[model samples]
Target chain A: MASKLLVDIHTHVYLPRYASLLRSRTSVPFIRSSTSRDGKLDERLLILDHEPSGGRPVGPQYWDRDEKLQFMDKHGIDVSVVSTANPWLDFLPASQASTLAKELNEDLEQYCSDSPILPNAPIKRLYGFGLLPLVPEITTKSLLDTVEQISKLPHLRGLIIGTQGVGKGLDDEALDPVWTAIEAAGLVVFIHPHYGVDNKAWGDKDNGHVLPLALGFPFETTIATTRLILSGVLDRFPSLRLLLAHSGGALPQLSSRLASCIDHDPVVASRLKHDARYYLGKLYLDAVAYGPEELGFASDVIARSGRYQTGASVTGPAVRSLGSQRMLFGTDHPFFPPLNSTEKWKSVVENLDAIDAVQGWTQTDRDGVRGGNAVALFNLVG
Target chain B: MASKLLVDIHTHVYLPRYASLLRSRTSVPFIRSSTSRDGKLDERLLILDHEPSGGRPVGPQYWDRDEKLQFMDKHGIDVSVVSTANPWLDFLPASQASTLAKELNEDLEQYCSDSPILPNAPIKRLYGFGLLPLVPEITTKSLLDTVEQISKLPHLRGLIIGTQGVGKGLDDEALDPVWTAIEAAGLVVFIHPHYGVDNKAWGDKDNGHVLPLALGFPFETTIATTRLILSGVLDRFPSLRLLLAHSGGALPQLSSRLASCIDHDPVVASRLKHDARYYLGKLYLDAVAYGPEELGFASDVIARSGRYQTGASVTGPAVRSLGSQRMLFGTDHPFFPPLNSTEKWKSVVENLDAIDAVQGWTQTDRDGVRGGNAVALFNLVG
Candidate 1:
């Protein structure tokens, strides 16, 4: 049997091309120079409005492949499935979106195909999920063209997309062809959250980006993913291969409740082919949710999803076998850099430790989450 | 040892006075006669604007106490900690709100104390969480007056409240006194979801009440509860016991993610006295989340909360004793009544079976959840 591999499927990166575009812009997704503690000008990524901390500090780790490889080597990560971080062309002018998306996709492919070797590392183990042009007014043909283009990129296993699809949401019927094209190409759709919940929902208080990132991001993912299920997205496109960020963004936990609601609601009962729980195996969840119990709970829920119709009453013990196979280890680095500059990134450390601490997880299960699943799902041979 | 009790803590009802108020109103919370399938006039309770299905059908189960006792007898529920269902007095006029709240509290108390003996039943077992006048116009004096009155009610354990406190939200500082007063009296605050989420989040579609009930209610609960924790409400009122509807409304699942977000964000980290996970034990989550995996997952998360800093690295197995003790059985009766009149409610059966099906759960845990916890939480001594 092959030895266990430590794969980071959820780490993110900004390409030089995208960074250049952001540096020229003055909007929320733009990059600006801010004075640091030492009174030196430092690059900051302002991705949201009224950001209390004046946005996060942006460094080489964000756009530098060397930094990503160094960080991966430092953390013993065998492979990094990189993707474009959020605010991905969503703010671009429609006319420029497709062109920029194509460029960004090429940039990512180039990054993945790079054979750079670090001093202490054996090989450059980097693959990426490309970006999509979801800005309004982009032609469907152009969108499908981008998908076709990304699919042909040998190193690109999948692509990341924000909640907004064709300017509505993932549930929008207009994205049917987009979904079909992606499924046809066998590319895993990484459903990442960028635009959090509405400001009004955040209430009149300013807790900085805590509410938006923590509550807003997951809540957005939950609503969008649910909307897709509720709108029969999964039912219509059975093998769409959707992967949600942030440990399915509360989906694993809320699925039973969502299923119960659907069963009880007359409008949805007839519409859905199966309960929400049945779709748990139909989707993949990135292991970015922090803490051992959190990840363990999510794994258990997804495992239950694999055996939705288990004759538990007669069988006695319930069977759950899908979670580890579907859960891919992710670091979500660059963002959430360590508070102490010299220390290891807490975000990465916490996520890795969480998997290590997960009770009942076998060595094989850990290996599956670490790399085996990503290898199978994304066809990452190396 | 005393025989284990089966208490339903999350069940709901509408008293005579509250029903009359709904009938008199012409808004979302109003009751109106609608033609049914059999060509008979059926009283429909419209709790939201343009609600499809013309609102749920109102019957004896909603407003009649004798029917409640009979339902309890049939279901083998030994005690019930009932509360006024959603949209409770939240829509009343200011001057009338306080008065209506007092009257409703009295009515609930009377319902709980009623000693009706049914055939094959040993006791008239019913306890209740009272109502509060939460309209904007109600003064602090009136709010405290209602709290003071309910605290004095022997049978009323706590009170049910919507996510909206004083029309702003639970995070509103103005409600500090309200939280303090409720805490001071040792009333277990049952935080229920009434006004679902802003419709914008639901998008341009209608799937009946599934969006609101499944996603909206829980989403609302998650946000409101998180806000309370974010605003340091739990830190201020350490002893306050808060019970969240629908198993903490996505709280247990999203909690770890919420904590991760907080740690990443400096503003929240500096502002919050504790991480989001720390509050899991501080708040009580009902097992309204169906499926053993779902309930078990919730219980597991809550149990983790009880021992946050468990030297789990040294301790081979994680200790999780907090969930069952905190998880009180709930029917959510009348709302998700059986679609077919003659059959047992799918809602009730599913919930009960879910408890019975929880993996690794002992008979003691089941009994405790079924009634023992409520018996202790509400001090519902017969």
Candidate 2:
């Protein structure tokens, strides 16, 4: 039997082409180089408005392949499925976004395919989730063409998207065809949050980016995914292979409330084919939540989604076998790197430790979350 | 041992005077009499903008004490701790809100104090949480005075408030005196949601009130509480005794992420005396979440918060004993009433059943959530 493979399905990368595109822009999403405290040069990626100190400091860890591989090796990560970071083409107009998306997709493919083979593993060390030009100006044909492009790329296993779909959000009817196309292509749709909820929700506190990054991002994903489910996208296309970042945000925690709301609402009660919790079982979640109890809770919600699918009572076994398999391990590298560069990233350690620590999980459950889930879901081969 | 008691800590009511006050207003929050489909006169409570057909249907269930008592008898609920529903004194001017708050406190005290004795339980079947004039124009003196009035009321054990504190959000420094007063008075502060996050987050979909009630209300609570924590309010007043509605919204699920974000942010990294998860254990969450899995998950989050209290590793003990004790059963009655009035309220049953069905909860855990916790928390006695 193959030894346990530690795959990271939620790591990220910014291809050189995409970085150059941002460097040329003068907007909030632009990358501006700045000097570190030690007199070394680093780039600041300003993605949101009113970002403190220009934006987050970006360095070789973001765009350098060797840095990613080294980070992987240092952390005992056997394989990484990387994707482009946020503000993904949302700032561009139609034609320019369409052109850049194609180029970036190719660059990502080349970046992954060019990676060296792992000494301990038979497969290449890197795989990628390509980007889509989901900007409003892009034509549906162009969008479908990009979907086709991503599907054909040998090393690209999925496509990463923000909450906004063609500028109207994931619930918009306009994106139904895109969902249909993605479903048909059999590529995993990685739903990540870029534009968090309105900043007004955070109030006037200068508590840095804690509220936005922690609450806003997750809340945004929860809202977007709930909207998508309420829109009957899941009901219409049951086979869509989608992956949610931040462990489905708060969806797993809020699924039962959402289902109750749907049941009580006269307008939406009869619209869904199954209980709202059922959809949770059907989707993939990155095990990026930092606590064992939460990870266990999320898995329970996912596992129980199966019962909801059958309209069965959810009072039986605490967890179904298939639910933990839907959760994949992720490091979210380059974003939450430790302040002390020599220390293991606390963010990564917390999630990995959570997988190990969650009660009721067998070694199989832990091993599955660590890598087997991603390998199976992404169809990764040696 | 005494018979297991079922206490509902999250039920709501609007006093006769408050109902009449709404009847006198012409704004969105004003109550209007309208004919139902069955041609019977019913009051429509419109609290938000663009509410469908004014707003939700509010009948005798909202303001009639006898109706509440009868409903409790039918559901086997031995005691209820009711608070004034949303938009509580938020729509009034400073002097008007202040005057009304005092009057409402007196009314709430009278309402609970006048309740009939329970046949099965030794205590009176009803208790109350008083209202505060949280409007922006209200003076700090008036706020403190209201807190004083509530503390002196025999039946009013806590004070219910919306996310807005003296106009600014809960994090506003202006609320420090109010928190200090509530803490000094030893009154539990029930933090509810009135103004959800900006509706723009819900997108263009018109899927009834699910988005706002299910997602927005909880999201609003999560943000407000997070802001309150980030501002060092908890650090300043550790024993403030906060009871959050809708199971702390998404706070438990997002607590670790919030801690991670705080650690990563240099400005707010050292702001709090404890980890974010510790704050959750310090809070009392209502078991208003609609499913057993969610209830269990929330309990786990609460229980494991102990480890984070001492900065201990959260890898051990899936659940701590004190955590489940912090949760109390809540019906959120008067709202989410059964559409088919002949049948039992599904909302109430879901919550009740959640307590019964949640895994790993001993009979003690179940009984505590059902009523024992509330009885102890509210200091109820025969």
Candidate 3:
């Protein structure tokens, strides 16, 4: 019956209170009322659209628990590890960021605890990764305290963060306290990229959202994770488990090149003797790659680079160890929504097809990637 | 015993006059002289150095024709279709740019005519791709006139161009005349990236040139080609041939996503009903990917995207009709110099190894990529 163990670690949702908070604001991340040609008032979120034409139609799917359950049931997802969508608490005032983070975490925990709103909804199938208050000027103490608070949330498994950290970047040494705290808390840092590469890179800048979303997002993830690798953050925090969005954002394909560049650089080599390939294994990647070939390649890269042992001859165990447990399924919902369609979301289906087509993948591996791995990794089930 | 038909479509060389011209300036693309600690005068070209530390030591290998023959022989390369390296003539004074380009083209043609300095060097194997002055203020007439003149150079195959055109980008409408002339001349445009994506994308404004070279170069190429695709250039000039560096700079992996974005966009869909995948088969990607797996994936993409027809399906005929003449091989020499060894250049060796690793690639296909394809595509042999 197709395992029926499918888990989506990449899905996103906007809770009711969060939606209300956005509707009350006036700037980015806010919803505004605009009159349609038919003269009806419509609420639009101005996140993507620059003009005053009300942002994309926001509906119950964004905020209502029933809709989330319905979508999961229709997609045959056994479990959905949801997280608040992008621009998450990043715009909140520094003083209010922490308190709001706490409230959101508690509210989300309550939602997960509540009964399934749909009949025949899969049992024990809802969990979430919480958000962090990362606005600039927030005290490191506050950030650390928030981490401490999130660590104790019964349903919170990890923290979702954007590329900008304290407004410098992920490479900033100032972020060491936060990294250390997150590592110490045994929480996975789900690293996603919100701010893409500079807009000038898009050239004459007329392709609309294609450049930023298709290229910018993944490229940003690649650069941020590369900075982390180059800065020796992985070495310092060996236990730091990073979950990269967009399937490690080109990291799997570029890992060899990264290693080659490091090997070729005198300065980089003098400080680090370990292979760059070794660090890739240390990081866990979500299976959000769009196709089976890409998924196979990502899996093969992890298998080859992360193998646990090495011998002198050609025949030897790999030096690092990773298994299907290291991978998780995700659906980058809310974003990449089906355009001009009322049928099933193409984005979700493509991802599901990728899982279906993974070559030589055992039932255990499939199960683990689908739901079992995330369940164990995030403690999704009680 | 090995294929003596080896061709290098990607090789680069800087002419002596051009080197001298750079030596006279103080800005980027100029040469600088400094006193070394040993009190010896050191002359260096600025292209290799970021902070202008007396620039990089310029040697005969960079400017001397005999040295080019020697390197080609040492590396077992039979024929080399060389072009002027990056920052080509994009910075020239408008009045002087076209004239200088004419002179350089003649100089290269004369050099190719008098080659074979090495013992038993292959006959008629050295060819050149001329340079164009693409900076702003240069009239489209001047650009067209230069192309017309170079079109008659027996050894000139095409023009090597950077991303910038008339200070806007490749997508600028002003480039249409230039493209039309080149397409009419049947010259294959070698598209390379010089100015990388903004340096700010690399973060901290420091970390040396690693970020730009390692990340920015490919990112720039990807954006430029995407702009060309998005601007309807392919549809406008279906006959124009383009060779992209760095295996299309992440385009293969992102093509699916690009197609999906276009499929979903109302603006893009309203104008173009064809899938983005259709255009990829028209683009010619060099085999400079750094590894076997990458090469395999690229080759697989070519086959899957219907760029490589094998009599297996309908897409195969379209790919086949495009001709085996479409794809070519290149060595981005002098740029990625061997880091720390006196051994054969690792960059060249790695590329060669990648060519060797692509499984089931026939000798015909192999020879074509090595040199025959470029020879036919550019009409290199007379």
Candidate 4:
């Protein structure tokens, strides 16, 4: 019998077309080459506008499909669902962003479709999540056209979005049409964080990128998603499938407090059809939280959300293991790579170990999170 | 055996002197009498500057000791560690804040010391956490003097401080002396949140205060406490006891992510002596999370910190119940009260129910969190 399948749903890639587009720019989010102290030329990818030391070194690992496959092979991953990395099409004009987003989506679709098929499984090794031109000047018609375009692509199963929606936040009512279109298309919406919270909250000490990457990024996702929930968008679009990065970015932990706050606010109490915890059960979460206890805890929150389902039984055995069914394994690869070239990536190893070590997670539950859930959620089988 | 004890460590109160002081002011953080729709006079408390509808109503429950005792009795709370509510002297001049801090400390002391002794216990029904003058202009000497004074007070067990410390955030090096003094005095520091993050993130929707109170408040606490952790304050003052409100305000959930970020940053990798998760074990958390899974998850995070201790065993049963030892019960009273005048507080009942429903918790574990943890932490058994 074949070993249990291992799927990575949170991996990222930068298509060559997109990289060349970034290289052509002269401002932030651009790529430039400089000489290293060892006398070798090095390419740097700078995404943040205010980054001083250029950005971290960039190479084939970012844009090469072969490098991703090789990395997956070394880590024993059977399948990967790739998406474009951050700051995607956020800075371009309507004309430029609209054109580039279409090209990138096609490039991503082709990139995944042409990948080698697995010998032991009846599926291709690669799948992709498309991008949207959510710029300030884009027309609603253009946005819907892109959604229509992605929905027809064979290998593209979802769309990756940042917190900023059409230059406002995700909660802005202006994005309602986009949500409706995406939901109707039956495509998953992968909500990620690119712009973190303001830097003033980090205080004076220069702690490198720890504050922004670790805390700010997740908190930004939390605020944006919570705003969307409070805006009654979930009530309006109950079938909208959202997969939150970093285990919903503290949302599961804060849902009960949120429910209590809503119950106390007369203006907000009657706004939703169900409690806040009910929404948590409805959403999918990537198991990227780096600890065993956290993974178990997030699954518990997701599973308990079953009790909040409409007409569902609130007692006993019914809600058990419901969370693991919704959680999918994620590597967040091409980011948080190890400094040493020969060493295994600690980021991937930590997540894998967490799944293995999580208490009360039976073999069936672990296998579900590791691959089976993604297969069911993304319809991976041909 | 006697029924398990119930102690509230996260409860709040407003001293009569402080109320009078606010009643005299005309700006935000002040209380003023206004006519209600029914023509009865109502005292409205305006804490946030931009609150349009005046603010929530204030009443005798805020300042009357008898009202507090009655509420405690109604909730079956045998002990309460009350602290002054938010915006505490934050708007006052340094001289005025210092004087009021001193006066308020004494009033709080008298309030707790004079409460009726519990019939089954060897302690009074009240204990308190005093306020600190943590405004923009407070002098260091006066701050230390208040710490010194609170240490000498019989009923005061800790100092309640806002996120801001001496104008800068909690990570400011300027407050190192205050940390030293408080640590030396063996006083617990109860860090709370008043100022949420900047408002622009909320967008154009009028979701009432749900966004700010539910997401903003806890996120603010998470950021402030994280800044403190990244600053290595816990490393400097290893024995300084901290009791974080809102179950460490997302700290336990995000600890692993923070540690991974620290490891990946070249500048931050070598800064701390231990991983970020270790500090979580060193602190105390109030059980105000409001959900069973969240409570269980936080305890697991806290308990696992035992593995990171200097010489403790990494495996075995040593850490099984360690987290319960550090988590204390709390009610956050006088806030989030029931809108219906005659009903019990949903806020209190939800938390109590959460404690009762948490999975894997033994009767002993529940008893510890309900009151034994507070008893041991505060030395309540004189």
TM of chain B, each:
0.93, 0.96, 0.89, 0.95
Which candidate number maximizes DockQ? 2
Q: How many residue pairs clash in each candidate?
A: 2, 0, 10, 0
Deviating ranges (above 4 Å) for candidate 3:
A1-4, A37-39, A48-54, A115-123, A306-327, A358-368, B1-4, B47-55, B117-123, B307-327, B359-368
Q: Rank the candidates by TM-score, best first.
A: 2, 4, 1, 3
Error of 4 at A99 (Å): 0.9
- Local accuracy of candidate 1 as per-residue lDDT tens digits, B162-255: 9878878889888888889999899999999876667777777788787778877888888899889889888899999999898887788788
**Candidate with more favorable, higher DockQ: 1 or 4:** 4
Q: Hey, what RMSD does candidate 1 come out at?
A: 2.7
Whole-model Cα lDDT of every candidate shown, in order: 0.81, 0.87, 0.72, 0.86
TM-score of 4: 0.97
CAPRI grade of model 2: high
lDDT tens digits, residue span A294-328, model 2: 78888888888767875576557556445788999
DockQ of 2: 0.81
Tens-digit lDDT track of model 3 for A334-356: 66778754778887887777666
Query: How do the residues B40-87 of candidate 2 rate in per-residue lDDT, one tens digit apiece?
Result: 998788988778655877878889999998899889888899999998
Kindly give the stretch of ten consecutive residues in candidate 2 chain A with the minimal lDDT sum.
A313-322
What is the TM-score of each predicted model, taking all chains together?
0.94, 0.97, 0.90, 0.97
C-alpha RMSD over true interface residues, each candidate? 1.6, 1.0, 2.9, 1.6
- Model 4 agreement with the true structure over A1-382: per-residue lDDT tens digits: 1237799999998899999988887888888888889999898888875663568888999999999999999999999999999988888899888999899999999999999888877788999999999989789999999999999999999999998889888887888999999999999999999888777777778887788888888888888888888888888998999999998888888888888888888777677777778788888999999888888888888888767655767854224366888888999999899979788899999999888888878899999989889988888864
